[model samples]
Target: MKQFQNNSLYYDVDVKIIKQSEHCIFYEMRNDEGKGSIKSYQVFPGIKLTYNDFHMGQCPYHNPLHKDILEINHCREGRFECNFINGMYTYLGEGDLAVNTMVNNRIIDSTFPLEHYHGVSILIDLEDAAKMISPILKDISIDLYILRDKLCAGDRCFIIRAKNSIQHIFSELYTIPDEVKYGYFKLKVLELLLFLSIIDTSEQFEKRTYFQKNQVNKIKQIKQFLTQHIEYHFTLKELSKRFDISLNSMNSCFKAVYGIPIYAYIRTYRMQVAASMLLQSQYSITVIAGNVGYENSSKFASAFKAVMHISPSTYRKSH
Candidate 1:
């Protein structure tokens, strides 16, 4: 096994895509064990994004070294964990943007939720990016070198919430038409960088975790247990007590690890289970709902429609 220090950051991260279109390239990402159906996208030169469904059950951390570039990651659907080399943990929740600059000294790895994690990543090549923006910032006292220093000099990762400006940018990226995505992506990428550069960096940083490893292992266990038991009901208090952790600790750590709260994860997993049952089993809708922990068929139907975007019967008929 090669040590992370010697490995290329882009190595092993290059997904093999069997399909290609004008705007997006589709690829499948497998686990270390080599049994996977995880599908992701490679958006041109530097951006890689994934629109995952119920996949990626065991994705190990990636700490590869890459050329100097800044990665702007956004969490649109479920959550994902982005960990820096210095022990700081940043959870990209829904509508959250994580700004990380890739450095040779500091490698990184990220874990997506067990299911339903959709996000976009835009990588700006340091040389090309600086050339485009440094002149623009000449009158302003800000330079790409300064921003680069702040991002990579020490332990810093800028975590921005989903405000209107950020939201609108991602919204366009998410829904950009296929014919225009190639050019539109370039424009949007630059637009987003300018937005980030202008933002007041004073309050854009959050220092939450410097992980101990064992605690993170416990949280991973929590995710594994909940995903396996889709029929069971879980509460924060019950889980925290059962796991010998404080409620706040459980909440924050779970968010940090899984990108959403415990209950929200449970709910998403429940709907996924129901979806599979609808397609695979001969059971009626009422029985299927009860099997996934819902007593009232109507309520189960509502929740299923909310997550899967169709009623049980409709889904069953289609699939």
Candidate 2:
């Protein structure tokens, strides 16, 4: 295993290159939170496609190495938080897409809200890509600079919520045969850019909610409190009073951060906990239900089926 030192090309202190080949590099990062790996493939001149898989809560602090670069990210699973330098935060959930230039709009912090994320990032070295792409096919024109201006004008990050057109382009990327991956990547990248070029920015740009730091902190605290005492259920009013935040703000911010409502998140979390206990322990379903704040085993079984798609007994037996 050769070690690609931190800060060598584009990485900061939190990552190291674990493997490398002719046209691919595998980078891994580990910290107190957890670990992740990025598999990068050089497909075209000044353009690369990277598959990002992280089991950790936070990514390594990113410091853009290139001055002229455009990053397009597609979230295939989990939620991603982008903390801007202007003291604002936004998130990218599954099937969402984000387009931005690293020069003007910089991300101060990047984290996975659910502590796990699987996604794809296409990094374009603007200067080099702009010069190289157009001449490849005279009939189809691709101008990187124009695409940047159209998508990320005024340093604003352009986000498109999950649409079938975008999904059609990205879904194939996750499952490509190794022998044809290199050629398929070129075709797909070009297809994506062509689609973006003709995209009506006016209709595609979504009004994303941005949360303030103070509100985000309070919401996080509320999450920790609720998760720590998962055996108890609390009302929105009670949580609002305990956290000293308004009721409406709590709902919106929690959804923004975790991509779900408070009731839904906790219910899913409790079921997950119950599922784990089911497999790992010899505890009966009634005891497990009570531990997760469900007084009735029948009710617990129903909820577990709703979330886990199987009864607690069946789930344990299958696993």
For each of the candidates, the C-alpha root-mean-square deviation to the true structure, in angstroms, is 5.9, 2.4
Poorest stretch of ten by lDDT in candidate 2: 1-10
Off by over 4 Å in 2: 1-7
Model 2 scores a C-alpha lDDT of 0.88
Over the full model, what C-alpha lDDT does candidate 1 score relative to the true structure?
0.66
Q: What is the lDDT of residue 25 in candidate 1?
A: 43
lDDT per residue for candidate 2 within 12-88, as digits (tens), equals 76788887876788889988888999998887878889999999998766566666889999999999998988888
Each model's lDDT = 0.66, 0.88
Candidate 1 local lDDT, 1-319, one digit each (tens)? 1211222234355444456554444455665534333233443333444444324544433443455767667878766665557665556678988776766646466666444467676655566556656565565553556666665446466678778888988888777787876677667765776676677766766556345455677787888887777677877777777778788777778777776678877887899888998889899989999888998999999999988899889999888
Task: Count backbone overlaps in model 2.
Answer: 0
